[model samples]
Structure formats: C-alpha cells, structure tokens
Target: MDWDDMRVFLALARVASLGRAGQVLKMDPATVGRRVSRLEGHLGRRLFHRSHQGYALTEDGLRLLPHVEAAQAHLSAAETPNDTGAGLSGQIRLGAPDGCANYLLPQVIARICADHPALEVQIVALPRLFNLSRREADMAISVSAPQAGRLHVQKITDYHLHFAAAASYLDRHPPIRQIADLRGHSLIGYIPDMIFDKELDYLANLDLHAARMTSNSVPVQLNLLRQGTGLGVVHDFALPHAQDLRRVLVPVFSLTRAFHLVRHADDLRNARLRRFAEALIVGLRDQVARLEQAVAQADDQANSENP
Candidate 1:
C-alpha cells in the first residue's frame, strides 16, 4: 500500500469528507476520492460507508485504523532526526472548554507559534466534551480527566474562580454580606441542563440554583457579567479581560479547578506531538500562574485602597 494513499485514507476517515481531506492534503477532491478507492481495491475491504452524512467509517475501517495510526506514528518518528533541527511544522488542533480557549490558549498558543513559525494551532472551544477517540481534536483540555479509553492525561494546572460581578452592578445592588444575598440578584450562569461536566456546575457548590440568565458558553457568561447583567462564578484568569468586574463574597465563596491535558494513547510514539504536548503543558502552567498572580495583586491593591 502506498503511504501517500494511506495518508489520504486517514484524512478522509478523520474529516469524513472528500473536500475537507483534499483541502488538508492540498489535493483535488476527485484525487482524494480516487486515492480512497485505490486503497480499498488494494486492501480488498470497503473502508467507508458513503451517505448523506458523508463517509462514515465501516467496521473494517474501524478495525484497520489503530494499526494504520501506529504505522503513521512510527513513520513520523523515523522522519525525525537525532538533532531535531527542523522547526515543528504541522497542524495541532486542541478541543477545550471555552473558558480555557478564550482566556488561556490564545496567549499560550501565540508563544508556541512564535517560537516555531511553521506550527499551526487550532482551538475548538465548545461546552461539550470532545471525542478524542474519533479524532475530533488531536488534543483536549478537560476540567476532569477521563478514567477509561486508550488515552493519556496530565494535570496542567489548578485555577480559581469566584462569584463576581461588574463594579457598576455591585454599586447599584444591595450589599452582599453572604451567600443569602445572591437570592436578591439576577444570577447569571450556565443553563442547568447545559452543564456538560460535574466540575462545571459552579453554583451547586454554594447550594444555589436557577440562574435568571444562562448560557453554555463561558465567554457568553463573562459577557453577561461585563454588561452588568448579573453576578456569577468567574475564573480568576478570565478577570484580566473584565477588569471592571470584582469578586463578591471573596472570603466566603471560591472554587478551585484543574485543567487536564488529554491525548490519544498512540500519540506517545509520535515525536512531534510529544514536543507540542510538552510545550503546551509548560505554557499553560506559566500562563495560569501569571494570570492568577496578576489578579491576586490587583485584588490586594483594591482592598488596600478601600481600607
């Protein structure tokens, strides 16, 4: 089997579309389809089930994938020299919850790409968990690590959050001496059913419910806070973007969560992915530490001035 054909097959399997695979390979769609056809003829197994939903992988294809992925990993490793002089080149897609994607990954990825000009990074920020098994993304940052699956997980960093609101909203509202006062304010937070992970259920820790304003996206929630719509749990790292927002019940309420770096098991053998993962882990730790410190210092300054 031609290695080039195997690449086309993998690309088609991943994206589930001829045009998308072709674009990734910089080849014509017809050429991509032809390559898949040739590979099927060579292997004597129909790899994909073609339909309106695009090319869904067949049972045979599913069985063949891990072997092919292993082979590809080996090939990629062999291509890397002992000195590793070449700049990291290739696309690395990361699936993350919007909080990290919006507040953290941009700056971290910026530095990564700056150091390696050839590298390309794509961040998919969604409220739901990513299916890394299906190659939804090469890597994922999750609130909690998974216990099952042929995968690798690493704890990136633990970050903090607090019940926070814009200064304008705070000034206009009744003083919040304790959690009980929250009942009088418009609570902005995730839609109850839309909380994808147990860790994302921020209000539950405080025995609170019924957010008058809700969204699945973190940025949307943050925007609601920025607009003085209401006070809600906000990540400390996200505070830089909304400097006007201030923590409420800081002495009484706080949430700590960690970000986990997850990747496919087979990626352990791929030198390029390993390098990218290392850089990503380091960058995330640094960014979280740096952002949290800045927030703490600002909080201190605010309190000192008021006192």
Candidate 2:
C-alpha cells in the first residue's frame, strides 16, 4: 500500500534479481526482500516466482504492473512545477537503438541535463530490442514505423540513407556509374539480419559485393567506414558531421527510413515524459531542415556523376 513499496516492486520487477534491484535502490538485499514480501502480503497474492536464475513475474504481478506503474507516474507528476519549491527530481529511462545512442544522443542529453539539473536520464541502449511494454524505457526512438500499441506515437521525420565510404576508398573502387555497378565492388553493411523488420532484412540482403565488413553496432560500422573498410549505408543525420567520409548515392535505387518517437499510453499523462517528448519533438522539427538539405545534396551529387 505504501508508495515506496510499489517503487521497490517496480524496480525489482524490472531488474529481475533482488540483489540487482537492491543495488539500484541503495538498499540491502534483505530489506528489499522484506518490502516486497510485505507488498505481497498486503495484496494477498504472490507477485514473483523465484528460481535459481532470477525472479519471474507471477500472474498476480502481471495484473498489478500497469496499475503500479500508473500510480508511480502520477505520483511523480503530482509534484508542483513552480520554481518556489523543489522541482521534479526523479529518473527518466530512455530507450534508443545503438545507432541513435552513438550519433544523436550526446547533444540532446547535454541540453536536457542543462535545463533540468534535478532530472536524471538513464539510457538503455540495445542493439535492436527495447520493450516499451515492460517499462524498459519510458520513451523509445525507433527506425521503423510504430507498431500496434496503445502508446502515443510521433513520426519525427523521414530520413534518407546513403552509401558512403572514406574518400580514399572511393578513389580506388570502380566508378559508381549506376546501381548495377555496386554488385561488382566490395561494400560494408550492417550485420546480416541484425535489424528486426522484414523490410530492413530485405534491404540488407541486397548484394553490395563491395561490403567487406558488417556489424550490428552502428558505431563499429561507422568506424569501419572511416577506416576505409568498405562502402556502408549510413543516415545523413549521422553523416553530415562526418569529416572523413563521402556520401555515395546509388543511382536508380535509394533507401529512406523513418524515425519515430514512442511513449507508453500511461506515461503520456506523466509530467516528465510529456515535457521531454515536447522538447524532443521540437528538436526533431528543428533538425528536419538540415536533414532535407543533406538528402538534396546527396541527390545532387548523384545526378552530377551520372550526367
């Protein structure tokens, strides 16, 4: 019944191990165990099933999760926003793909930290999977369109990707006269089947013979491009700032991807997520112009080569 008890429950549920959960909450394992046991006693239902590996949510726990999370979100929002009192002070968990974490987050994180000094932002970076339903992250940045969910979704922008390589790498490869020519040269790409969606998987299947290396990690892929490993597909958002690489437009076929921002249905009403979503949307809108310019430049470069 106590709010702190519910907080402990949520943390424990997420971390899946009493020891790990206690570490997160700065509590001893025994204290965490006692609090969870107390919570279960109050509810008259077992919340977790313990095993050698870790704890798994029981049917009762699954039923209570949404309500518990909603209560916590609302409680956080109940704080007065006025500057005369203590401001919002809690952690916000964000989920992003490895690529976004590496390329897009640092500036936004710096800005968010500067504006809300009391707010703590924790990023859960994964190669491709982040479970918004389990509250792995309150907000997610995704490459594909948002799937079926009650969550509020926003399409940040449609981003174009380009085949790029180190300038030196291009100098040695056969001239990219057309898309067909890509079949003959070695290229680098994302690790095969690393992305989840069917469309992305199909795109990865494209035989860019020039691919000599591939990886699921975007930073690693980018580093390979910089090292002149081979031609690779990269987003312009991550490309414009690259000083060492040149964008190579594959004539006849160009790949564009959309970026979306997603939040859970319950968290949309929370104070922290609402404000953070607004700032992120604003930042994305501001970046749209720059994104379009990059696309146009890539097209222009491609046209010049063909003409």
lDDT of each: 0.89, 0.74
What digit string (tens of lDDT, one per residue) describes model 2 on residues 229-274? 6777777778766757777755555677777888878886677677
How much does candidate 2 score in TM-score?
A: 0.83
Q: Compose the digit string of candidate 1's lDDT tens values, residues 1-307.
A: 8999999888887778998888789999999999999999999999999998889888998888777888999888788846275688877789999999999999999999999999988899998899876777888999999999899999999999998999999999888979988886889999999889999888875656589999998999999999988889999999998899999898988889999999999888888988999999999999999999999999899989997
List, in order, the clash count of every candidate structure: 0, 8
| Candidate 2 lDDT for residue 145 | 58
Per-candidate TM-scores read 0.95, 0.83
Query: Global lDDT for candidate 1?
Result: 0.89
